[model samples]
Target chain A: SAVISQKPSRDICQRGTSLTIQCQVDSQVTMMFWYRQQPGQSLTLIATANQGSEATYESGFVIDKFPISRPNLTFSTLTVSNMSPEDSSIYLCSVSQRADPTGELFFGEGSRLTVL
Target chain B: QQQVKQSPQSLIVQKGGISIINCAYENTAFDYFPWYQQFPGKGPALLIAIRPDVSEKKEGRFTISFNKSAKQFSLHIMDSQPGDSATYFCAAAPSGGYNKLIFGAGTRLAVHP
Candidate 1:
């Protein structure tokens, strides 16, 4: 099992501003992912943060909006740029261990961002 | 075909009773199915999971029943308690990948004590 820690558990941001959420894992992981959960909604995959390369984003999400940086195997950051009210949601960091084949993912507490 | 359809947007169950949530998937390539539980102001946690090779998997009070031919699965919680009340999500992913899961909308459960 991998333990993930995320920074800025909760933040209130003004429109057009950007906030970066940091995720730090206890050990090197095979995969790191960013997800978003709006109020009363399910989790949505934002992107996959890859080490030493550009992140792979899901459809309907763009780098210009949700840029990701994975400096190494144990750390990554996600920046929500030019925030809007629609972007107010809980952003989560999840990781898959290198030894797991069933694709089980463990998640952090999540950063709750409220854009006003 | 990436969609996983979940039913019963909300549910209210009495303590000591049973709570069930159902989900159906469109993609046959999906072989891994897992259920996650989320409490208020917290991220979702893995509850239980089942593969197509197994008809059912049980862990403590939670059980996952999978029907490969029907392309459907359901989560059952026996002797539900107020502490068990939370939003549950069902997810599916193909094998041999990074586990880019396709999640269901989620079901909010309220257990009355």
Candidate 2:
């Protein structure tokens, strides 16, 4: 099990501004993920943060908009660029063990962003 | 593609009663299923999980009843307390995949005293 601590638990930003959310894990994990939970909606995978490589994003998500940085096995950052009203949501970072066959994810507290 | 679906957008149960939340998935490749619990303004934590090999698994006050044939699973909280109120989400992922998860629409459960 890993404990993830995310910074800037919440923020209210103006449009066109960019914000970077950080995630730090207690233990080294093989995979780290950034997910967005829109208001009253299910969680959507924004990207898979791979160490030393470009993050693989979902179809609707792009690196230009949601850039990711995975410097090591225990840390990663996600940047929300050119924020808009639609980007207001709770962003969560998740980590998982490599040896476990089950896709059990340990999540961070979350970063609540309000774009005005 | 969103592979998982959840029902009963909201539920209200009295204290000392059983609270059940159900979820269904359309992907047959998903072999591992897990449920997460989240309070307001907090991140979700892993609550309980089940593999399709068994019909049901219980831990403490939480029980996971899984049906492989129907591709459905449920979380049953026994003797639910008011503190147990939160949003419950069910997730599924393939065993050999990249560990990416597909989550379902959450169920908001409220336990009234």
RMSD of each: 1.3, 1.5
Candidate 2: clashing pairs of residues? none
Error of 1 at A86 (Å): 1.1
Candidate 1 structure quality by residue, lDDT tens digits, B2-77: 8999989999999999999999998988988989999987778889888899999999999999998899999999
The Cα RMSD across the true interface for model 1 is 2.1
Docking class of 2: medium
B1-113 in candidate 2: lDDT tens per residue?
45788987899999999999999998888887888899987888889888899999999999999988888999999999999999999989887763677888999999999
* Model 2 CA lDDT for position B58: 95
Estimate every model's Cα lDDT from 0 to 1.
0.92, 0.90
In the order shown, the candidates' DockQ scores are 0.62, 0.62
Error of 1 at A70 (Å): 0.6
Model 2 interface DockQ: 0.62
Worst ten in a row by lDDT for model 1 chain A: A96-105
